[model samples]
Each structure stands twice: as C-alpha cells, then as structure tokens.
Target: MAPNNQTLGNNELGAWRIFSLFMLLIQKGPLPSAEIYAAIYSDLSTDSALRTFSRDRTVLKQLGFAITEVKTGKEKSFYLSDSNFFNSSYDLSPEDANQLLVICSAILTDATFVYQEELRNALSKIVGNFYSLESGKSDSQKLSASSQNKVFPVLYESLSSKQLVNITYTNSQDLVKQKHLGVLDFFVSQRLLYFVAQDFSSGTESASIKTFRVDRVLDAAILKNESFSIPEEFDSKDYKLLDFQLGLQADTLTAFVPKNILAAFEHFSQGQGDVELLSNGALWTVTYAHEDTALSWILAHGLIPRSPESLLAKWKGSLSEVANGC
Candidate 1:
C-alpha cells in the first residue's frame, strides 16, 4: 500500500510490501498506516491504496511480524516487540560478553573438545550474538585451553583446606623431584593454574611459597595433620627473589630483556631494576635467584636473554662451537 513497485495494481499483496513495512517500523520507530504509506507507498494517489496496505499488514502478521500497537489513539500505530535483537533478558555487560566469546573462539582451536560440538555450538551462538552487540571495540585476549578436564577445584580446595600434597613436579630448571609440599595458595597465571607450596621434607618449617605447575602434578593426596603459616610479611606478588627454592643453595644474579619483552621478564624477577637498553637493542641488568629458572624462562620465550657474556655465554658459545665440530 505504501507506494512499493511490487504492490501497484497487484490483485494479491506481495511479500516485499510487507517486508518493507516491517523494516520501516524497525528503523524509523512506530508510525500509523497513513504516515507509513505516505512515506513509502507510491500508490497513495490511487483509489484503493489504503485498503491494499491494510491487507499487506495482515499478510505481514501471517508471516510472523508480531507487530504490536503503541497506544489506543485515533491513529493506531504499531512496532515490533518480539524481535530477538531488542530483547533484554540476556545478562552480560557488552565487554565481558564479548570477552567470553573470544574465549570460546580460542578454545575451538583445541582438538580435545571436538566431541561436544553441540554444546560448543550453543555456547558459540550465544557468545557470538553477545559479541555482535559490542562489535568494533578492541578487547582482544588470547588463551590456550587445557587438555585436561576441570582442575581448578582440586587445587583450590586443597590449598584452602590447608592440606599437604605429595606430587612429582619439575622445577624451572627441568629437574623433576618428588616431595611432600604444603599448600599456601592457588592461583591462575598466564591461563595455567599454579599451586604455591612449601617443602615438607623435614619438620614443621615455614618456607616461601614455591609455585608448582598444576598440570604436571602426577598425584595429589591430602595430608590432614600437617599445617604451616604463610608469613604476614611475605607478599605473594613481590617475593619472586626471596621465595624461590630449587633445593640448591640460594644465590643472586642479574637478567635482562628488551623493553618489549619486559612483561614476560617480570614473571621471573624482583621489582628492583636499573636496566639499560644496549646499543644492540637488548636489555642489560641484574637480578637474584637461586636457580636457572629465570634464565630458562627467557629462553623459553625465545627472548635471547643472556647473563654477563664473560660469565655464562663465553663457555656456552665454546660448547656450541665444539658441538658444531669447529
């Protein structure tokens, strides 16, 4: 009825007329039939244009446009009230909702969860729709999903209950050892859960919480009798130097990385530093640690970190040359 090409002189109402009327109401908000047709119907000058558009509304209703009236007035107006995009029952802020979507996307890269595709698709659709509402904002986060099923509860409950656990763990130096450890805290770092522990090799002794990879733990048994105190003075975040224990005599050293790599570097170092950007664009500095974990971390990140060339690299390079048959 509203001057659309498909509606002029047609005995039966066309689908395009109904679709255009619905889109007009959605985009421009509610309007009465006279205003709606005057805005869109080219046949408004014709004799039967009003009756034709009224029939079009009936066609739209049959096609599922749950259009509702705004008020009981001389001029009746209508709008879409049942649209999925306009619904407000979903509970999530635009940003966190999108973040949850990204988490779903990144997890799909893992082959371990392929069998649960139906559940994954449902979550994906929900999150994808949620993300669509917050499109064009940059809040990107990348994380790898664990191959194992839920492990946080085991670690969290063990630490909260003050239980001692026996586990086979590999330290930063790749040295695997089996020992009884008292749980101090459970935390997620870089998307992996770590259990902070104290060595229970001897008597009831208080020690700094040394982090153990939760995934690598071969076995966990709760020892009900043992208990220990985490020093009030000890700060979990700043004690990287003071708290480290590799079963080796504690000592100090310096490590550095380029400023761009400083974020990964901070994971292994204390807060203090006077690092200088060298002419070659690498960082040079000092740190203190009892074990080679700090160095190994840098190497693992492929950041090419080095101790003083005179102390560590000269011998390392010599070994490299000999291994190369030079």
Candidate 2:
C-alpha cells in the first residue's frame, strides 16, 4: 500500500481518504478510477472502493477542488487542474492566485473545517518556498498581506472570542442587508472568502445557519455588547456544506443511482442533499453552484443523471468530446 493510504481507515467516514485522493491526483497526470482505486484501496474490490472514493470526492468538492474528467472511450480519467491553475507562477494579481493567497492567510489564523491551523501554516510556507525560486522573500510578505478583505481580522477575532457581529452585507443580487451573526466558520470557496454564521437578527426562527461572502460585506462591526457560544449539541460541520449551497445561487439536480452504489452515493452527497426510496432504485437531489463540479462527479461515479438540461448537455458534451478525441 502507498504510505498515504496506509493509516487511513477503510471506510467512507475516514477523512484521510481525501488527502489520499489529493496525493493520487497530484501525480504524473490524469488517472482512471481503476488505477486510483488500485492505489488507494488496494485491498478492496472496485465496487467497495467506489463507496469510499465517492465520499472523498464529495469532500474535495466542498474544499473547492476543480476535478476535471479527461477521457477516451476506455475509462474516465481525472485531472485536477485542467487550466494549469496549479502550475501557474505566483503573482499578485487579484485573480485565482490571489484567492489562494487569501485562503492560505485565513487558514493560518482561523479554526478550519478540515485542515488544522498548523498544517495549513506548513502548507503556506512550503508553497512559499516553491515560489521563492522565481520571486524573493519580500514577495512572500506581500502574499500574506494580499488578503485585501479588510474585515477578515475582525471576523477572526469574533470567532476566537465567541462574540457577535453586525455586518452590512450585499447578496449575489447586490442588495445590501444588515445582519447580526455569531461567526462560526470563515473559509474560502471558488475564489471567494465566505463565513457560516448563526443569524441572530433574522426574522425567521433562526434555527438554521447561513453563509455569507466576506468580500460582499460592505461593513462589519463586532458587537461588543453581545457574546455567543455554540452549544455542545450543535455540530457546525453538518450544516456548513448545505448552507454553502444555499448561500450561493445553487441549482437543484436530481439523478438516479443504482442500488449497488446508492448507500455510497447518499453518504457522499451528505450535508448538501437527500435520497428518495423508489421501487426501481434510488434518486438523489443535490444542490450545487457549479456546473462543471456536477458533471465531474457524475462522470467520476458513473451515475445516471436525469435533470437540469445544462448538466445533461455538459455530461453528453464530455462524452462527445471523448468520442471525438478517439
């Protein structure tokens, strides 16, 4: 077994599977599922391996990895950075590179959903070391300060102290609204920094959490008069993904899953969707903001998709591309 997959458990709940997948995808090129399964789950059969791989892929999606499918007629092959985004030289431009820098800065300070602060710090320095070959040390300093979101430090302090905050936020529609939030998770996705919080100022029951884009925040002031704490019963991880789907202009997607893989599919789509029992098989409806993401997952898993003409067209387009390539 590879060193990466050795210690991770054999089940879907083993989060290390995600790191394992990363290690696999970061290798010498696009790899088919058969090879990936062989490398990560050498002891398990293909059916058994897909169960865990599906869950790991779900985690990757949550973390904003754009896993692309490159294939011929034989099998689907996954290539992590199709746009060469991973190999691009370090720059100060306010684009994807800048977004990565912003994320690195936040992970170095805030409590995270997956990686630890120390781990993230190590990754930042490692990437910095790589970038040093081209640029100098001063560029690295610029990298840290490049997180131009002015409200970031206050949000970090708010989470650290369990303090409440009043934020004037602009939604996707560009309508600005005021919210008093208990800052929970501050992280980045698809090149934007977002935070999940309990909205104390909402008119609804306020039982559910909400995600907000930090850059969209017009102003943020920590409410010194109020403090908040998460109850022992509340699990932020469970709600974070679903709220993120809602936070974006996410669309609903329904698909059919074979009985053989239904359990794994259900587990994989956790936090963002649900399953319906049917006489024939099972149906899964997922809320996602990115079309490429949905297409990649569907291709990677070999699931039968039913809705959202855009996705189906893209899925067919993927197959047609492969066919044309052959």
Candidate 3:
C-alpha cells in the first residue's frame, strides 16, 4: 500500500467502514444503524471489528447524526432521526446548481476583490465534482458554461493582512472616477460580499469609507501606499443591508400591491421601518428608508395610487412624463 494507506487493524477498518456507511445513510436518508452496518460491513465478521463497530456507533451519535434510540421495552435499536437530511436532495438541485454557476461567473468577471484565484479554484473544485458525477449525461443537461472566476485572491490576502490597496474605481453613478481606495474591512450577509472602501486621495481633508458590492467591482490592484488600520468606530455587526439608503428621495411612498403578491409587508419592511396598513383595505402605508432600489422596485410594479383625485392625477401625470421621457 502507499504511504497514505497504512495497514489497518480490524477496529480501524471497522471505524472507516462505519464512517463511509454513515455518509451513505445521510445521502439515502434515515436508516437504522443495524441496517447501515449490515449494508456496508456485511462481509466483516470478527470480534475486534464488532467491538470497534459498537464504539463507532456511540461516536457517530455525538456528531449530530440525528441518531435516536428506538425501543418497545423488550427490543431496542438506534435509527437515523433527522428529517432535514432528506431535503435539498442527495445531489444539488437544478436551480441551486445553476445559481452557483452564475455566482461563479460573476466572481470571475468582477475586478474588485483580490482573492479571486484561490476562492475560484475552491469553488471550481466543488462545481467540478458535481459535473464529474454526471459523466454519461448529455452536454445540454450539464453545467458546462465557462466563466473567468474574476476574484482577486492575491488582493484579498493583502486586505486580510491589513495591507493597503490602490485602484481606480468608479462611483455608483457610473462615472470615470479614479482614486486609491483602502480596504478597511470585509463582511458578507445573504451570500453577498461587501468591501468597506475608504478614499485614499491626497489634498482631501479626511477619508470616508463606503460599502461596495463585490460583484459590481471593475478591477482592483494592491498599492504600495502606506497601510492603514480600520477604524474602531466602524462596527459591521450592527450593520444591516437595507439600512443604506440609495436612490429615490422620499420619506414615504404610498402604494398598492395586489393581495396575490406574497409577503408584501415582509418585503416592504426589510430594514428598520414601520409599515402601516391603511384603513381603506386596498392600500398599504409603507414607510421606508427612502432607498432608490426599494422605490424603483415599488414603481416597477406600476401600482395605482389610491383615491383623492389630486394625488391620483399627480401620479398619473408623473407616469405620463416618465413614459414620454423614456
């Protein structure tokens, strides 16, 4: 055997076999331990192996295997108990697999974060394993699309080490803005990475840090500029994604969503805000953070404003003006 594969005692062999069987049980869902042992180690019949098998059973139970004891006073046995293990399929779903592929594509194309190469390799390994399983499947049925996996693993390491980065970045408005941006901190929520960028231009009084979505980044390069410490005042723990107000300038926007729109209140009151249900039963009083994305989303629904002819007429006129402009 190779150096990696040393001679195994009967007990070690039993433990290894049991571990493999446990993974199969998780994939196949809810099997009595006895059934699992029989399925994987039916050929093994030795005293030491049986003793090792008993110990492995206890170890597996402690490792969150959802194993529970089943007893009817006279008979007792252990069985797999978790129901969630059956969810999301033994393999990745078509939709979720596709979503990961898209994310990989975006990461490849994005030029912001400096950790793409390393993370992309890791992500690709996961994706490659998935595709390798579908060897005989048709090309159309497989995830064969190519993306660059545009993450800057090198730049990411620099940020992680508290080193400074220099890059020309455009502001949110899509202008040709260039400046050295210091990466203060990095955090992720809901699978989106946020880079806290601080302006590092001279002649500017002070630097102000702002969050940028990693996916939208154009490019990043590590600068030889002096390194800076992240401010203690900045606490990402208290930060919430919806708290940042972007776009539309409105204290409140009154709109109507059809009853069929699922979880309208949950969608509207994402951040810290109050949503009041109007008395008329048709409209919802939504007090939001006056964000552009939220407003555009609400406007995109093309909800008709309610009652009081003047308000309705104003909205109609606004719509007509926007339509003519478009």
Full-model lDDT for every candidate = 0.50, 0.61, 0.50
Clashes of 2: 0
Instruction: Kindly report which residue pairs in candidate 1 clash with one another.
Output: 2-41, 3-41, 3-42, 253-287, 254-286, 254-287
Model 2 TM-score on a 0 to 1 scale: 0.45
- Per-residue lDDT over 96-195 for candidate 2, one digit per residue giving the tens place of the 0 to 100 score: 4444444444333334233443344444344332232223224432223323233555665567567888887767686878888887775444444457
Cα shift from native, residue 237, model 2 (Å): 2.6
Top candidate on lDDT is 2
Q: Write the residue-wise lDDT of candidate 3 on 46-118 in tens digits.
A: 5644675667766655443445556635545555676532333345544544455444443343344334455
Better of 2 and 3 by TM-score: 2
Candidate 1, 33-110: lDDT as tens digits: 567767557656645667766677665565445567676477777767666333344355555443443333333323
lDDT of 3: 0.50
For each candidate in turn, the TM-score is 0.35, 0.45, 0.39
Native-vs-model 1 lDDT? 0.50
Error of 1 at 15 (Å): 48
Q: Lowest summed lDDT over 10 consecutive residues: which window, candidate 2?
A: 128-137
